[model samples]
Target: MLRLFSVLIAAGLFLACLTGYVLENYTVQQRTYGGAGEHLRGAQPPYPAGGMDNIFWFLQVSDIHISRFVDPQRAPDFQKFCTETIDVIKPEIVLVTGDLTDAKERNRIGSRQYEIEWQTYQTILKKSKVLEKTKWIDIKGNHDTFNIPSLESVNNYYSSAIAHLCGHLHTLGGFMPVLHSRHERGTLELELADWMDNRRYRVLVFDHDLFSFVDLKFDKWPVVVITNPKSALYSSPAHEPLGKIKHSTHIRVLAFSPAQVTSVLIKIDGVTMGSAVHIKGPLHTLPWRAKDYSTGMHYIEVRAQDKAGRTTIIGHKFTMEEVRLLPFDIMASFILRSSHYMTLRVIFILVLLANILVIIAFRYLTRPQLKESPGFFALVNFSFHVFSKTNILYYPVLLFTCYIAVGPWFIGEIVDGHFGACFVFGVVVDGHFLEGSLTFLIGILQLTFFNIPLICYLCWCLLLRCRGAYFRSHIKYTGWSCSVPMHISMLGLLGWQVYACYLLQKTYGTAAFFLSPVRTWSVILALVLVYKAWNLNNSAIRTFKADMKNCPYS
Candidate 1:
């Protein structure tokens, strides 16, 4: 029985080691969620039960520099950590807030360098469209706006568009939604409709120049349409691909001077919509067909007339969109020690071998001397079996360490909006969780990886039994058939190192070079041996107690 126990112990230790190695080192697949190059994120469960708040609003971002030129003091900001925060959380809406690029600084005049910056932004947006379905909108951004010779050549020419919107022979004051601010101060969208009952519903367009204080749109929810809350308006033009555009759709209403000899009129090619009085303070609603207007690749012209009937027609056209998404490799910015992964397998095998040698040497040395005790064989067998010293205080530390090592793998699910994973993490690793905070790395080496095995080995030593002088060294073990046994979940969890390797390969690809099968099994081997040692000590102690009671020692 004692010899059989020894065999079982050795087998268990070897099997555990093998399981860890095989799992850790395999290669697998490339993981890219939501198509974004950088999807890495800390965990966050699902949205709270309630719907989003009305006061909340997200930014409309188009072009912001993140490369070698990021500046904090200047216009473009480099500390884009907030941007990442927004991306993972999935805000309400992000309209296209334009001009993410400049002339690239080398063009001498910023007018010619659109090719590099323009395309990159578009691709990023397309990939990051992981927000809730109804939230994403792409308004025309200035950087993406058409490059033309004059204001008339631009698609959203501000001044002339407003003049034609009023239905008068001449008009003044209204602007289209254009480049917004780098930091959206309040609600991203604003409405000024109630105060402008008499005026047309005008949506003020803001871009680089339009941001300012005292603007009525300030502090208001973006749903508000009119810019000048007190005035009603219209603007530039709302164009269609096939029909003539009415420079009448997008605009902001400025100061209203009623009865001031109105002359502005809106027309679609040949038909005139109507005429307005220069003194009309507000027009009430936007052009009848404003919402259906065409955008990029489309064109329109609005004719504006001053109070004296001095008229000029301004035209704006946008070419069809031809840009495509950027390639995914752009995220290589975070890569370190890139490789084909050649030496990983060899190193792991050698480590496993060394560990086995150490285990053998430990068993041979420092064992207690034998004594002429009748129950020695029975004690050895009983002590080496089940439920032994493995439960020593050190195990709490090891369990804590394993929790840390395996816990970070689930952070992705949390960030992507799964509440369940959060609870699971809390239950498994205690509230603080391992690898969650940054400083965990400093504390990890001192963690359980080494100590857990050491504890198990120590317990196994206590399980050995000896008899006569010739058998001076104690060595024997046993197993008990009837026992409640520890929870299987604990054993399964101990084997998690194997699963972790498979998981790594599954995420990064079977060819990924970071982990090796052997490394994973090494952990398993180490833990299993610990468990067996504890089992041996418990079995031997119980049988020794029973045998001595039965024998006539008196």
Candidate 2:
């Protein structure tokens, strides 16, 4: 029974490894959705009624962050460029989605030149005749609220409120917004009066710091513009609608933002077809196909909006029919063009080689022995030997190994010029960098290899448990109290990290990315240690019970 369970667990792990890692880039499935509700309305582009496919193009300008102080005259040049762009593309709508001006301040509280910066921004929009002629709408971004102390105030307020909720607040005032800072925190809403007749549209501002939707809602106001549906790579659709569309062809869009985008809107011909199918990630992916609609020529339009009411639109004319998949080389070439793909391939190769080396070494060193001993016992014994007082020299070695497993992230940050001596963990961090480096890959492999024996034993345990039987002779119990604190501390640290990363996500977009590998290793290492200690405790208890049988006065 135990053997059967082990086989099942091993099989499951193998399958997961194959599907999730090896074959991940082989093929991507097509996702399509039909006309949905209110969420779709804001995101989908306007449907085009029966018309011949013609060459029409549009322009998109994002993250303009126009600042007067940064470059005094660039604003005018920017306006001139916009004027030229209008003449060139003659876009249907000029969408300006947030960051109209740059605050040009970081960490220096209350020192922003908001008035001059915004004056420059407003002057550019007014001077640009193209903005007047073309339908252009502006959305508020973090920088646009330069004078507002929303981020600092809200962070303090929420932090205090959370502390109070957690039963740590003895004082009543702790629940209120902390006002110790020099500047007063304004209401985090930007009001646009009468852009529409007799109606006011309020653009709620945010710090763009959110890890979960629940945390977003806790802020009591939505902050951020809705973005277009995006792809895994945070890209818009790849296939140009210029040629005939095949049933197997995919229309992919990468629409995601730290500010949080809600829904995807898609349209076919003159009618709203459906919502864009979403694949959520740190960068979300949205995909669709023309086969979801009727065959023949159809106009495909997709729009994505973020929570802050900002919108982006894209459309193409497609001719849909049954067609074979694109050749593998063609797809591979496109995917390989991406730096991330190359990096992942390199890391995979490195890890695979490392594991192969470890396996070969273990096979060569170990002698085959016919035995019926539990693998868990051996793991516990080895761990005790390495960590016990008798092996005091190995303590520093263990610490060094753990540090190596975590050094990659810190080193990567230092190389990127984001490291500061004041960071709590003594690692450099600002949170906007999400991509990993070679060091990160090596660190993960090192950690994985260090714990490979325990990981294997855990897998074996699963197999044994699945078999529903095991030798009673292997059973043992002992005191695990001495090791409990270490295991608990590790687990507690992991939990705190997850929560901290979640809360700090908006401030540092890469918080989760930086912590992910560390958290993974911590989980694996802590769980193995805890399980080993448990077995040790059980065996000790059983040994004590056996020894009692020979008591002189039994």
Candidate 3:
């Protein structure tokens, strides 16, 4: 128990340190969401003083997660921009958007976040020179005002502070109303002014999901006009009827790859009421470190208000697309033109070579002699040597490994880490379960070389039992010959893993499969393994019968 506690403490400290390093080292860049169309000087409205109508540049930044995972650079960039904008432009009013902290903000008191985010906010305020100066205010962004303290609660909590800062609260408070007004019955429900108009121009803060919606403003209470480009978030049928939508049946996108042009179909129980839109370009890929990213909900209901003041709701779903990726040479020559295909190919070759080297090493080093001993014991010993001698000091090392390295890696955070290794694991596991025989030939060389050996070793260890004594005997042939039941159990596990991987590949596409074909092929190869197992089981039974014959039919 003491050893276990020590390990837990050590792991916690390691993770905390890692997270801290990321937060401290990185730099932030100034990013803007609103006030893109026009620019104006600060603390000065587009119009003169004492005018009931006013216009000023405003920025809305939500989900501003300031945590270990958040790029540290973003925080400082925000501070610099705020400082420069405050010192130079000095707008009449400023609204600091919500979601200031990246930490797990279940509680504001004991959670270490108060000091971090509070200080960060204080810096922004000091640098902006707005805290003691202009009409600066804030409202709840998703991160800050979400479930933890509730948007309403946080708004109320910060109300006094914001009121002391500036009069911009009146403008931001109506931002959500402007955003929702486009929806059916989305008329500006706020009993407040929705637009800022002077002799020069008009500015509006619309607060709907920007990707799928339009932006507009005019000199009317409920009557407004949209004059921006089409929003990326909405899903329109490929076959639009004229310029208008005739029958807006719901469409669902099962899968979509913006670059690669791939997608799958989805089946909603009833009529599909929404179409999923996934668009990936150069920007989202850079900072997010995404090869091919995807995010969509199972359900999104559509609704709108008519000219007669009645509201109608509709449902929709549509086909999904898989962003396509190919060798850059192929694309450049035959498709879009050169964009670093050769570089990727070179890297790919290097990785393949590395996997081959590792596989050759593992098969020779770990393969045990074929005798009456367990195979899993050999694997355990091998892993112990590779990872460290820590396992020798404590048995919990194995459990901890499975939990940390395997369990969490498998169940959570599928999007992070060395993706190629994971892809190979998926390929081999999937092939054995679902595809069938001969799929082994399709296994990526890397998966076969690297991942298969690991699967074989893990299976062997899991089946042979947790105790070291269960596998005492070793031989020059099999290395460690596990008993018949143990061997069968290991084989079965490998088969299941293969099946699960194959399914993931089929459903998600072969981004990972191509990365590690060997593992993918092993999964396909699992089918052939069943016959091998049956033959071995029969051999074991036959050998037992022969021994019994000499023992006198008892």
Candidate 4:
């Protein structure tokens, strides 16, 4: 009945996994929409006839990392930008990508959500009054997700946004704009430089259906965003409709500078299209026939130079048709985005399968036997002769096996300020189970390689003794041969524990010593076990001939 039950459960799990795999593959192929660079030829354009007239601008900031405990000045600096720079730009919207607060403790080893940091972030927004001036959108970064059980948890202090924006990498010196492909089907991914150090932000302008942006430093001038001929790199008709550039009559540019604007020049395909005339504040226009270059993709360059000799040149590919990401880019994006969940899934499946295999092997080994078998069984019977109940080594071996099965292998702060115990079952963080922990993986390994084998060896010995098998005459000759493998497995497990301790010390600092006392003890235990196993294996081989001399056949 037990075997049938195990077989049924295994079959069900396999079928469920196969079904999910098939469905997932089918869904992915259908969602790809004919793979990379394929466009819907007859799709309606995003912008109407007068694309330049429908323009709006927004401000984007990322990786604020506001930490009152670490960098107290960052909060005030961000506030200053909100008040001074934001007032000048007067953007229609403000998008904060992520990393609103630094979740690190003073030691920088542990992580937890600090209410004070979140309150500081909130106070800055309210004090700046920037929230009232524009639509503010903020999302959680990887830092925000640390130690958070879920998004709905009270510990999660992030303001909700339409989409999630990542700011964990602090990539490109936080000065350049990047589009991550992992965002949901119509979502746009924009990563901004950190407000903690660089004081960088982006001014993104959308004119008609064309999107143009400029990365700006705090108080820096000559902010330029091309208002016409949208960059082809950002073209996504599935998400946002694009304008038909064939109907455009003039090139439009928005350039802002504290000093006098000297020249705003336009270029198409590297050829000069003449200087643009300043029509209004930050608005420059140059007449061009968009129909001439409408058939193929063309490069548009806008150079804005001020009286202060500050030259800012921006270039982008513009085309009338839609553009799609390459297949490799799409696959990479999917892998990166799903990496966390994928790891959890893979580990869970591997552990599950390992346990199932252990159960099957245990059942097969302990099956009822009419007569003693040869090879491995003969070795087991011979080894059990030394492991009889009366032997002095038997009690020590049994006691050690039981201790390892139930003992607390290590104790540490599983999450900031929360001390917990690790057992064979799993790691208990505070009072709750720490899901998807690597410590738990180690426990499973110990059970498979060390505890189970030792327990089986002890049980086999008792079984032979119950059958009235006599081994006292050969006890002095046959040493603990089976015990060697058991000790070696324990040594390996202890070695793994030591490596884990080293990693903890490297990552967390001196605090690891105080937090995990078992790490130090494990090293001592491993050395002792290695010495005992070596002595026992050597004694067993030396006594083998003596045991054969006492046999009835000899």
TM-score for all models, in order of appearance: 0.23, 0.29, 0.25, 0.59
**Which of the numbered candidates is closest to the native, going by highest TM-score?**
4
In model 4, what lDDT does residue 298 have?
A: 86
Per-model lDDT = 0.31, 0.38, 0.32, 0.61
Q: Which stretches of candidate 4 lie over 4 Å from their true place?
A: 1-52, 69-73, 112-123, 139-164, 172-179, 182-188, 209-220, 321-339, 343-537, 540-554
* lDDT (10s digit) by residue, model 4, range 240-356: 444445556668888877688899988999999999888766778887876687566788998899999988888887766434322224433443455544454466456545544
Off by over 4 Å in 1: 1-488, 491-497, 508-519, 526-534, 538-554
Candidates in order: C-alpha RMSD to true structure: 25.5, 21.2, 25.2, 10.1
lDDT of 3 by residue, 313-429 (tens): 333332122211111111112211222344344444444454444434443463323233435454454433332222221233223222222221222122222131232113123
User: Residues 1-554, candidate 1, lDDT per residue (tens digit)?
Assistant: 69579979998998898566433322122221221112121112221111211113233333343222334222212122123323432335544333334433342322323454545444454554434332544433333333432344423322211110111101113332221111111122222211111112222332111221112221121122122111101111111111112222323221221122234444433455454223223221224353243322333333444344344443333221221111112112111112212223333334434444333444444433333453545444333332232244234433444543344323222211211122112311223332222223212322334433444433334433211101123322222221112223335444555555555344334432133322344455456554444344434445444433433321
Q: Model 2, range 1-554, lDDT digits (tens) per residue?
A: 69569979998997798567534444444222221211222223332111212213233343455654455555665576456435433445654544556666443222344566666666776777776667665555544554343445321111111110011111123232111100011111111222111111122111111001100111122222222211112111222211222222234333434346676676657677566455433222234453465354355566677677766665644433322122123233233333553555456555545544443443344322213343555433322322332122223334534454334422222312344211112343454333434444544454454444333443333222222313232222212452255335554555754553443333333533355434344444555553553344333234322322332210
Candidate 1 global TM-score: 0.23
Among all windows of 10 consecutive residues in model 4, the one with the lowest summed lDDT is 30-39
